[model samples]
Target chain A: MTWLRLALANLRAAPLTSLVNAALLALGTASIVLLLLIGEQFSSTLARDARSIDLVVGAKGSPVQLVLSSVYHADVPTGNIVKADADRWAADPRVAHAVPLSLGDSYRGFRIVGTTTDYPALYAAQLASGRFWEAPMEAVAGAAAAREAGLVQDRRFAGAHGLVDGGHEHAGQPYRIVGVLQPTGTVLDRLILTSLDSVWNLHGEHESAHDNHEHDHDQNPEDEHDHGEAHEHDHADAHDDARENTSMLIRYASPLAATTLPRQINTESQLQAAAPAFEVTRLLNLVGLGLDGLRAFAGVLILTAGFSVFAALYGALKARRYDLAMLRCLGATRTELLWSLLLEGLMLAALGAVLGLALGHGTMELIGRWLAASRGVSATGWVWLPTESWLLLGLLVIGVLAAALPAWQAYRADVARTLAG
Target chain B: MTVLQIDNLGFSYGQRTVLRLDTLTLNEGDTCAVIGPSGCGKTTLLHLIAGLLQPAQGSVAVCGQRLDALDASARDRFRGHHLGIVFQRLHLLPALDVLENLLLAQRLARVSPDAKDARRLLDALGVGEFARARPAQLSQGQAQRVAIARALVHRPALLLADEPTSSLDDDNAERAIDLLQDQARAVGAALLVVTHDRRIRGWLAREVQLEPPA
Candidate 1:
């Protein structure tokens, strides 16, 4: 404690140099922590939303974009797959459940998804207020969409002609909100859910198209089109179906489905099937490299801060060498002089670490709030990683190493010659 | 009472012998001045007695304890408890106040720090009010007095001052020598002053002269 006072006095003597070193260290630490926070939140959210679904069959295009669009609702859809084709998968012995999504319109930056009651069941999205829609043009608002857009029962709003906001509004055919979903903490929280007929009608398609979607979506026991070929079922009707271009979601019934299903659909059919897990992994691998680059850049900044501390102490020692010599004469051991320098370096690092951690978390929180407001995703929080703790320890080690040369110099200084001058 | 003694003392800087004192002694409470030329090794002889430098061929025994037989650390401990040295330059720590400067010496010597003794010595030197002021805040004379107070803080048996009056004018120089002798006598310590200034020669009854080394 006695030595600490002396070290603090020395630090206080040169305030500007100490502050600059600390600020640089804080900047480096903040960057490292922020990077980890972003990486963890991003990968976890993707993994969380893609857990149950196995394959997404869509129009032939980018597989990653298919998963990103259908599974995560972050990109443009790969067009549409036939609703009957989705039903054929749903009826397949190997398939557990198939959910179809019709995308291409949004309200205030939130996507309005036209899906079945199974969509709400998939995400466990219970209605927080009012009932789930049963009729065309009646919509259930997602928690985030409701809260952000101030959506309420009886409120009518036109959806623009894109997955995201601001393409062109279908102002004449506005849909009324009947329900608001409880916060499910998934991508479902950011969508407005309705029946597929509402979507076709809103786009001003033929009225019979809405009746066709509603008709073909259920069990058509007495159908005139499929009386002879009962086994081929929805597949023959879906070939001429206009909804063939729309994207469809598929869930695997067994592990065998993963190996056989997507490959068969991609190779043998006009549509493509992309696994969410596989595509999300590939997507993150590409993004991780960029994040790693950013983290490495932050590491370099911390290294430079270490060098600055070393230079500051070495330079200051030239002037204070006499003080050390005098302390020796006053009966202070050489080791005490050395420790003073080491302790000073440690003090600077401690200040920087504390300040850096605060800055790092504070910066993350600011970005998180912005993301929630702008992107409708909460990606920042007070999450501590073991690596961050290790990073702090590494910083302290750097501080000690930075002080070694200066402290050793102080220890080995020629006291007789120093005082003689 | 204990006294300072040196026999066949010799100290060298590389090939050149800087100090060689065949015989030197000071009894208890005695006041003496060592007068010498610039290259006569007066300071070197003082360092030999203080156990700061090793003599190549002689024994330095202070109060019957052979300093030459002690190892570096032992010699340092022996010097700390038995000898007080005041350097030519006032090498007070700029970081500490005047009182802390004196207290630090006692602390480093591994002796119980007595604030009362330190304050009393500072009071005797007329720098009592500057006890809390840093060396940077003090004038040359005040810092010099503080340095003297630091040396006498532990009240060692032998007090050594190496050209302590060299930077002072005649009036201040005489006053400084008087103050050093007065404090040494009060503490029952033998005072030995090494100086190039001949003015202080008249103040001391006993004087030892060191001729320039060959």
Candidate 2:
């Protein structure tokens, strides 16, 4: 038998120890691999979805919440900003491009976004079939939205009132699906796009009813009489600029707009401008602490695995001294014996590496499926980050280092003394 | 043809000499016993012949190649091809089966695996039925037969056995010596048995005695 075969046989002879060491290494490797998968998918998905849009302008609230609602459709909007104010900003010379987002409804938990064709253009989306919506009540379904909700071209479906399912459905005001978008691998894939008037007209009567009902309730006199007039005055101001959008996604015309525009909007208007790049960086930084903690835990596990491998080899070597001498008597060179021991360590590491990678990717795919089901944002396991290769390299190094002492002992062993003893 | 020649060989550990031999020669198909009490360096003589140690003085040659003139690795290669040693303990690797033990011997000797020859050798030693049996599963006699088969599988120029029959009864000891002589003659190898067991002296025609270090 070759030295490698001998090494493998030796490992098989101690199946439990070999398996435990391999499994420990696998656990550490899988953890690191999973972390890389999630971290890379999160950042890359965020980057891809937010590439075109520079800033999100919305009703005064947290900039992060505005970006989440308007750009990602992940959270509820901070509230609505007047469409007239957004229109004036879009007409500004510094704004290169703008898309109005009138969000507030969902169909089967997928958001129905009121946007112009420019929204699809923002993601460079293309039609899978049919055409982009050209009129009110005509909708273009994103790929995921189309597939999930069964929104085939020419089909009509009404949306629920809120961002989530189980809300009141506007059954009478159903929209015709004019087109289905190809998968852009972006946030747009989870949205249904329509003319802004579709949202405004649909909410028109509902808004007035809600306003008057609140007005009557305020006049109840027992319910805080001091705010009754203030409530009515606020309703009148809302009616004066009745057309409103949840947010405006904007792209700057020049680098100067980056410096002045968000500050200008925040100070001069009743709106908050959130830079997607800045918000994304802040988001990653916020999540970085947890990622770092998991990374450190993975490092500790790997270190422990290395130590366990060393201990196992050292222990086994002590028991196998006679075997080594026997091999020497059988004509094996000292180097050959040394390599046999080294091969055992490397084989264990190799087994762990293979098992770890498969476990990591499989677990990530399961998580991706769950995330896709709930949030409409999936992190795929199919992606292989470059750092994963480095992970394998690190494991091999650990295997070698763990085996080094045992191999040296085997090499330096006095065969005659050992055999006689 | 002469298979082993030792002349004025000396070996030491630190400040003490362990072994000194004036001259000894053995030819192909020859059987000899180096007999002595314990600590008389009989095993050391086997080691020196196997090129497992560098002699401090004079020369030990196997198949006409001087072992002391070779580098460590070269000596290892020479020993692998020319020498087969059976330790007193019959140290068969527990991980390998009886058959794999023979195969491993061939592998370490850098000889191409001849499964037929290995199996035939095992059959010759009356351990053919235990070919697949692990060393731990074998009786002491069966393990000894397997160890002998492993040593002769590659057809070495010289076969060295250290206390091959010390653990056996008189009948088994005579049988062990007969097996060694027969196998060595079958492979045309010079046979040298190193033992403190005086019963072994009567079994072999040619004998040499090693006195304890003074």
Candidate 3:
């Protein structure tokens, strides 16, 4: 108790030094914690969305963009894959299911993803209310989108022009909301899902709807479904059903299928195949490199903070030599004097660690709110990272190291000489 | 019973011998003063008896315990429990009030401090009203009084005051010496005052003079 009393009194005697050191420690802790939170959240989101998607088959443009658009539901489509080309891949024995998506419209910043029921089935998404879209001009909202729009069953609303909010509203064509999905913590949670037929009808690209329609059944010789659609309103069409789809998301039937399918499709046709696992890994590595550099920068800052704590305590010890001598004269042992300063350092760091954690998590919450509003993805930002304990331990070690030199000086204080004058 | 005993005691900083005493002894309830010329190591002799310095040649026995024979920690504990010290420039802790400074002595000695005793000592020294005042807030005389109270609060058997009157004015110096005598008599402790100041010489019944070594 006496040691504690003297230590606290000593620190109280120099409040400015204490506050400065504590502030430095807090800033160091906050930056490190913030980096960890954002890094973990972003990477895990990438990994989770990439896990089930095996490959994306799309037009011959950027494979990276095709993968990003199909798997993450972000970025513009890399032009359209012909319906026949998409159907040929979909009917392959090596492919488990090839879900088609027609994108390019949005309802309140949430991407209106025109996909078949198999797409929602791939995510195991269950409807929280109403039912999945089964007919043309019907949409089902994911949990996040439903919360944003707050639409009731059978509510009719027109979509916006582009893939985000604030686009000019398409007034003439309107779709009825049929259902809302439960939260899945996947890309599906941010989408307005519907059958691809709704997209074709919305764009007036369906067989009967296209102004100058043409059906080329000879193009898909292997597809049994196309045999009945041989007849064509064979006028020159500006935008036809043949060039309808944005991309096709492919799931392989087995591990063996991945070894040959991507290269086979890319080489044999004008379409490109991008495996989600490969593409997402490449993307994260690029992002991780930047984050690693930031972590290193944060490490340097923390080390500098440790040095700041050291310099402050050492300076205070020098100025308080008279008081330290008095303490020794009051029968405080050298060990007691040493421990008091060491405890001061630890206490400063602990205060900083706690305050910094709050600051970091609070900042993350603000970012989460902004992202949810802008991208419709509800970020789980308040994550207790597994590495948090290690980070805190490192901070404490820095604190101890900072105080050690000052404490040693305290231990060797010349009580007799200091009190002589 | 003798409270302090020294025989052939000496101390030095490196090669220069700072203090050497052939023999010095103080029994219980005795008051004595050591006066000397400047640089004759007046303060060093007081420090030797208080276990703040180990004699280079001989042992200092306080309360019949050989202070030089004990290890560092035990020597500190011995000093805490059995001796009180008052310095010329009073080193009162600025953070603690007058009462807490006195209580700090008892706490360091591993004894539960008696607030009543501390207050009574403060009252005896005429600084009882300022018990809650910090060292910086107190007048010089009042802070000196608190320093004396701090030394006496732990009920030590030996009180070593080094240059206790060096910085005080004539009247305050006389008053401080009188207070020390009264406190030592009341506690039944031996008092040793080391100073080169001549103003305190008339009040001392027994005195020893030290000259620098040739």
**A1-421: candidate 2 lDDT, tens digit per residue:** 3887888888899999999999999999999999999999999899989989999999998888998898888899999988667766787889888888889988998899987778889899999999876556789998888988999999999988999999998888899999999988889988998876567657864876434433443244233112111222344455324567899889889978999999999999988899988998999999999999999999899889989999999999989999998888777888888888888889888888989899999999999999887656768788788899999999988998899999999999998778667
Encode model 2's per-residue lDDT on B101-150: one tens digit a residue.
89989988889999899999999999998989999999999999999999
DockQ of each: 0.37, 0.66, 0.61
lDDT of 3: 0.80
- Report the C-alpha displacement of residue B88, candidate 3, in angstroms: 1.0
Q: For model 3, what fraction of the real interface contacts is kept?
A: 0.62
Of models 2 and 3, which has the larger TM-score? 2
Best by lDDT: 2
Residues B1-214, candidate 1, lDDT per residue (tens digit)? Answer: 5588878888788899887788888889888999998988887787777766678888788998887788756666777777788888767877677887777788767778899999999998899999999889888888888888998898888888989888889899999999899998888899999989999877986898888768
In candidate 1 the C-alpha lDDT for residue B72 amounts to 58
The TM-score of predicted model 1 comes to 0.86
Indicate the residue-level lDDT of A151 in model 2.
94
The TM-score-based order of candidates, best leading, equals 2, 3, 1
